[model samples]
Target: MVRKLVSVAITCCFVGSVVAEADIKNLLEMDLDEILKVNVATGTSNAISEAPSIVSVITQEDIKAMGATTLAEAVEQIPGLHVSNSVNRLTSLFGIRGIRNNNTPNVLVLIDGVNIAEITALSVPYAFRYPVNFIKRIELIRGPGSAVYGADAFSGVINIITQSPSDLAGTSAGVNVGSFEYSEAWINSQFSVDDLSVALSITRQRKGNDSERVTQYGVLQRDGEFDNIHVNATYHELTFNGWYWRSEQEMGSGAGIIGNDIDRDISETISAQLRWVTDIDKFTRFETDASYTNHKLDGLFQLFPEGTWPVGDDGNLFLPPLLL
Candidate 1:
């Protein structure tokens, strides 16, 4: 339970074991209300254990034991939250409570209190699975949190805390492999100098299609590979966090028609945040934060295979023999 959990692919990993002991906060032992009372989930800067609600906490240990290699798989363990598939791109759908949409925008997702939900094309990020190799613990609020997080918190909130210098003893690395040619590897490093502390983690994974999904057209291709990098640094009350992840894979099916095997779906996202906590006066302390995130989804889709004539001279079109 002391090892770092590496998230790879949706089919290979299933956090569907999400809790390890929280490093400094020891979240595994804390009550749900006490956990929610912190992390800016409320307007008042005070404990609110008196509030009634349902919640769940998963630590690194829990995530590893459950064979979870992706954030989506780990989150599936939460009660009332279901992870489904989406055809729009290769992304996953998050259904909380009774509300299940293409993207499930009602549920807010955050990493270190910063929102990562997509604002344009989808609800969550562009990728189907996000690596959890750098996670410390995941704290969840399974009910309305509009008062603190705004409109996106209607269904619930998933707050992810990344590892800190104190969380890592030194350096750690591991590799994971599963069926369907799925494989993953990750490395983590932590160090301290004077008052400065830094933690860095990187992960890479790839998977091949199961080659068993057959349709009228033919078999489906779901092979893909992903790379992720995360860094966290702390200097006094100021902290800096950044992340980057890229994914490329063949269309599981296709947006419109069966994509050519040569076609692929690619997506990339990057985010950076700077946070500072200082005392406004003698009694009250104020927290300030600034962040930036960019997400892009792009791909080459060949609905019609090569050697096929889209504009045929003859009135009747000739189809590929295999397609028939």
Candidate 2:
């Protein structure tokens, strides 16, 4: 139940898989015990597990074993974190170490070492729905990380790692359906041309507010649909990833009013990242990273239900007739 858990999830499932370009053989054989011994900082060589903060890492196997559907649900299993829904949009919201708020502010989210948090809101839009099908692992830091990760890593950091080619293992697809009219479908494929390897995933999901207890205005209509595409490629020392996601989420309550159910919030986001790594010597490694992201959101709000506003020539609200 970490604040910005959705963003962390979206950072994982939104962008999807990762490419283990350099040192694939070594990375493929490393186990959790070896991972725990890995050093993050190249300068001071600090161990992530025993550093100035408390840290936890959750593997993909762990999530699958838990039978958790969403990334928020998976992260909530950790202690000292919580996740809940926002009032109007019903987006994911939670807190870290008792620092609770409605929106994400103090937490920093990263996917494969790339920053994907929306600049203005400091979190992904609520419209960005995340599924757990594509995640590889999650890293949580419960204390200060500002000195290493910059200003946004105040309360904690949720670093999501994605699946590699060895993990995906060619192509696979699945579908999920259950109560509340919820359904999800996804496909993952991987291929290699000579030394260039590529992995891709596409997902579509929808959920209906069928539960009488899901919203305050149970009589009003509420539902949402999401589509996402992700691509990861690698050629020796160079690696790249790109993602496209779109969502149309219904607002169960009109601007948080007690009993008003209104319209929808729609959004689209495109993100890309590139990285390079090389061994400088027997004891040194050189690495560089770059990323780019663009996103847009629109709230189609309705103050009242249908027929509340006068119809116009275009079927939208007009200036109304002049009073005599």
Candidate 3:
């Protein structure tokens, strides 16, 4: 099913890119597609072209252009990744080479080298509730990285690389409003004082599928509004570095019709990390990362007495004929 058939959905979700052409003239002048073709000279020895595996590098500029709210959404740009919208709000299912279905753990998710996929559920929560605007870039390796990343690296690997203090050396902000009253806002900045460098960012956004009302199976229903807030701060340099990230999300349809209230879901995560990098000599350097993360999920569903509901699967409901 994954081989002979190919489906590509190119939806242009607009993002405000009105940066004065002169502000970033250097970047604006360069052809991003061409630049991406070159291999990265710095960082780990494994360059894009040199690696023995398929790797797609997605830059912040690409992310901005796509207006993607999550990592899974951004990776759709890769050639082999097929898109599938799962029924579960908390999970996303995608595969390459016909390797994915309702159950697949071949993809390993990493954020700054830290594995983020849930152990029990076998998937990373990629819903809009997560903070992805803070991402600087993403690297998807369509092969085994288990030699270095350990298990969960069999099918592929996803690296969510966030911005460094130097990347946000100045204040920057963006807000977008699109069809369906979807709105997003983000602000980021960096401060430097002698030997210390600091980066801070905050983002908030909301989107709903049914801006008015939606009928499913003849039942009048409304999609719940989804909202999220994220905050992060980082201090880094040669000797030592530290960072903290926190985010919260909530979704609920405000008191549904017939008083059969819709369920509410809330999720939150907090993370902190400390790292030390030491250069022992001209040819050798050592670095280590110590980190901690805590996540919480809450779901609230309403129960109604049997036979007390009038709404049908076809969205057809019978109300006492309005007395004129």
User: Residue-pair clashes per candidate, as listed?
Assistant: 9, 4, 8
lDDT, candidates in the order shown = 0.72, 0.68, 0.55
Instruction: Estimate the Cα RMSD of every predicted model relative to the unseen true structure.
Output: 9.8, 9.2, 12.4
Angstrom error of the Cα, residue 190, model 3: value is 0.8
On the 0 to 100 scale, the lDDT of residue 185 in model 3 is 82
lDDT of 1 at 234: 91
Candidate 2 vs candidate 3: which has greater TM-score?
A: 2
In candidate 2, stretches whose alpha carbon ends up further than 4 angstroms from where it belongs are: 1-30, 33-48, 214-222, 255-262, 304-324
Better of 2 and 3 by lDDT: 2
- Pitting candidate 1 against candidate 2, the one with the higher lDDT is 1
Winning candidate number (TM-score): 1
Runs of candidate 1 exceeding 4 Å displacement: 1-40, 43-53, 255-261, 280-282, 305-324
> Could you give candidate 3's per-residue lDDT for residues 89-156 as a string of tens digits?
43566676566765347777766655555443465542434456778888777766667566677777
Better of 1 and 3 by TM-score: 1
- Judging by TM-score, tell me the better candidate of 1 and 2: 1
